[model samples]
Target: MHASAHVDTFARDHLPPPGQWPGLHFDLPELRYPARLNAAAELLGGGVPERPVFRTPAGPPWTYGELRARVDRLAHVLTGELGVVPGNRVLLRGPTTPWLAACWLAVLKAGAIAVTVLAQQRPRELRTMCAIARVGHALCDVRSVGDLAGAGIPGLRIAVYGGDAPDDLLNRRADAGPFPAVDTAADDVALIAFTSGTTGRPKGCLHFHQDVLAIADTFSRHVLAPRADDVFAGSPPLGFTFGLGGLLVFPMRAGASALLLEQAGPRQLLAAIAAHRVSVLFNAPTAYRAMLGGLDGHDVSSLRRCVSAGENLPEATWRAWHERTGLRLINGIGATELLHVFLSAADERIRPGTTGVPVPGWRARVQDGNGDPVPDGRPGLLAVRGPVGCRYLADPRQREYVRDGWNVTGDTYVRETDGYFRYVARADDMIVSAGYNIAGPEVEDALLRHPDVVEAAVVGRPDEARGRVVVAFAVLRPGARPDAEALRAFLTAELAPYKCPREILFLDALPRTATGKLQRFLLRARGDTGVDTDGDQQ
Candidate 1:
């Protein structure tokens, strides 16, 4: 490994041991990065200084040169005034905006690890992540600072943007000249992304400077083939890796521009596509389904490429979208541990229901419980290895995720004779609702906090509107009424709105195994019923 430029080595010291790390591959030429590299510098330098980089509906596009200047200034504030050193963890919380993207780049340029979380995350969730990551500084939007401040993290210094405070991030200027990028090692930690797991604890995935560029080179370059003239737009928040790549990293890496929207629902996304003439789009299957009905009044002729992920894209949704827009959706399966899409197909190579073969520089196969490869057409766990692989931050679960140098994603699939992989179901208990991965246990914990609830279990139920909706089954205290609306309202105060259960049912007793363990499968079976508690078909 190259000598690190980090003065604080907390991130490096906490990385999973070499034996627990998944084997990394860099067979492609473009995947080879120099020993000393700064991802922000490479990304910024790859773009034409005069070309637009970020755009919004209410404002003019910010050119690459303008973005670089802003990033440099932010880096100066982080390193000079904030007294941050390399390897310090900086938590970023804000809506999707150009300034939030700039803050991400500035953190990398200054050689600090960025812990970017969703602005909608509750104080409890934020507190858990901050404690696990040892985050000391925060760059938050003024509108979203309440939650982070209420988290009450010890010694966390917050600098708000878009506010009238004298120390607002945008108001702090260090110098007029460019700030030199830190000479960091290629393997130096750049970001710590926290992902929800079945255990209800967030797993922090450690990524390096080179790992950031590797995704752009492998998937975005070889498969997506984005051009400099392409205008990108997406519905995901910047905190999600899907949005991080599609909205910021991939576009800037290709010298293209992106439309960053603070509110990108189906309606807002359709309007942005018509107003900005977006050619490349990224969204979940649920959003695509929602937009299909609204496409008649919008002009989407500028759309050339649309990528679907976060959940399996049903063949029906794919067909309906292709029939309407004459555009084939690029269906992909990726995990937060892998950073970006490693298994995907685009253009003429795409199949209706199956996720395409492994992306360039990546290898994937279906493995049995014993880590042995399963025969074609047999369902098994999906294991993948590539230039970017799993490396948890001092977590014991790393041993469970990486087996024999392969990252075993908790997803079951079938590898067909044609080499295409078909999605089956989540091998774990994670609930994929509206493109967000919600832990069933996390929601159950929130329900259990209510005074009227005695026991609770949560699961994902199939829905025509959303790909899946969180359905909860609970046993209330004796003589307490079954008030689903009241329970939902109480939960809303404890968890994010998305994580709250959409349907709640009262039960006298919960199913359990003979060994006294909760039988979640029975709860899932209950959720799969076609009729609701009132005998109305769902």
Candidate 2:
């Protein structure tokens, strides 16, 4: 792992650091591509037309040449017909369609920052994001055009991609082209990605010209490692960094193929992979588990890598997948603040349950309550620092994120002796009872080990005196009926009395974000945490 090992790679060196650390190898020069064009410009430099760049469910396959052609036409229309001036924010909203991809590239090339808003978001959420981004225009699907029309944002121009365009706006036309690339600096703000604000309101995370350098060098280098001929496909939408990177940037950057499905469910994902012969697979653990049964009829041997992130990777889920597929599921954690997971490992020798070491160009540490360094193998707040940093637009949360320069992610983890960090759940997700502080995930992991459990989410519920008590939500596999009394008896034997949930709530499904993360904040709203407290000493 010498610094010189990655010296010649295009994306390996990016950060401001100069000399390399042989102890933990990193190269600053190779970490980024030169900030010539926006994210779209850097990705489409690969000169090929027939080579697949993006594949949609209903339309023709967009190759490197075809994607670039479409982008050129779209940028031409956006500049000529739509009058999209530079620095103007365009709210690119929709599913992962070819039109959206073309629109995203057009917005960036038009010298406007592309603001991708997910379709799953409520109207209120859309209004909030649009207002914050100062959105001058919106490129959405046909279904959402009307919803956004009545959103009450004044004079916000709306253009439906592939659907009917507004009267003044023009769709794909004969009179558009001769588009020129905008000269953008490395520090120019490229995107304002939103982190799910479970605690309160969503915060805007800004990424500059050099940001994609880290996404490709660090994330792509470590996780997917896609090649030119390889075909990429995944379950996440283009709006999510998971989908944007996994399905779009990573593949197109290397001149690989991307299958962009507008409807990315368990069935569509499997069918697309088998139909398109997708090489790289990226989705949540729940998606992987749900698709396990569907793999029997599909020839999915094209899958080279399967990346799991956005939630804690339970041990049972990981093992079950391995037993079924004989392929390793790469696990990592990413926050919108950091843009993506700065830490991940793809190669073998990966420990079963540990989130592997930090990827190149990033550094992480576990810190104490006072932000001091914590001892190894002890759980503490996870703090990270690298090329990307958090910037909450006009929000005081920025003060909470930056501490002595490092971004203090709201995650609790323990760095084991081998340098791997084991995720213990979010810091707020910890439960305290009597005196000892117990992590809800620990109990959930114990329950998942019971074999009958298919999915689990542990949360701290309200308690009368001890503040909050442990509560468990369990989703059992079909044909296995493990009742509350029997499961509680089993958990009591394995866990400390105070740590075990006083009650278990059964559910067929859990609330989750589009990226496949459990929305534990919902559990808190449900007020499910209560202790038995049957005359037991407190």
> What would the TM-scores of all predictions be?
0.83, 0.89
| Residue 478 Cα positional deviation in candidate 2, in Å, after optimal superposition | 3.7
Task: List model 2 lDDT by residue over 225-297, tens digit each.
Answer: 7778787777888778777778777877777878888787889888888788888888887788778767788
State the TM-score for model 2.
Answer: 0.89
- RMSD, every candidate, angstroms: 10.3, 6.6
Report lDDT per candidate. 0.87, 0.73
Minimal lDDT window, size 10, model 2: 1-10
Q: Which candidate number maximizes TM-score?
A: 2
- Over 4 Å off, model 2: 1-26, 32-37, 164-176, 479-482, 528-538
lDDT for each residue of candidate 1 in 1-538, tens digit (9 for 90 to 100): 6788999999999988888888899999998899999999999998999999999988789999999999999999999999999989999999999999999999999999999998888899899999999999999999999989988889999999989888898998687679899999999999998874423588999999999999999989999999999999998778888888899999999999999999998899999999999999999775786788699989999999999987667666788789999999999988789988999999889998788999999999999989999999987899999999999998999999999999999888889999999876567666788798776756775676576776677888988878899999887767888888999899989899999888898777776421123566777777888435432446
Weakest 10 consecutive residues of candidate 1 by summed lDDT = 511-520
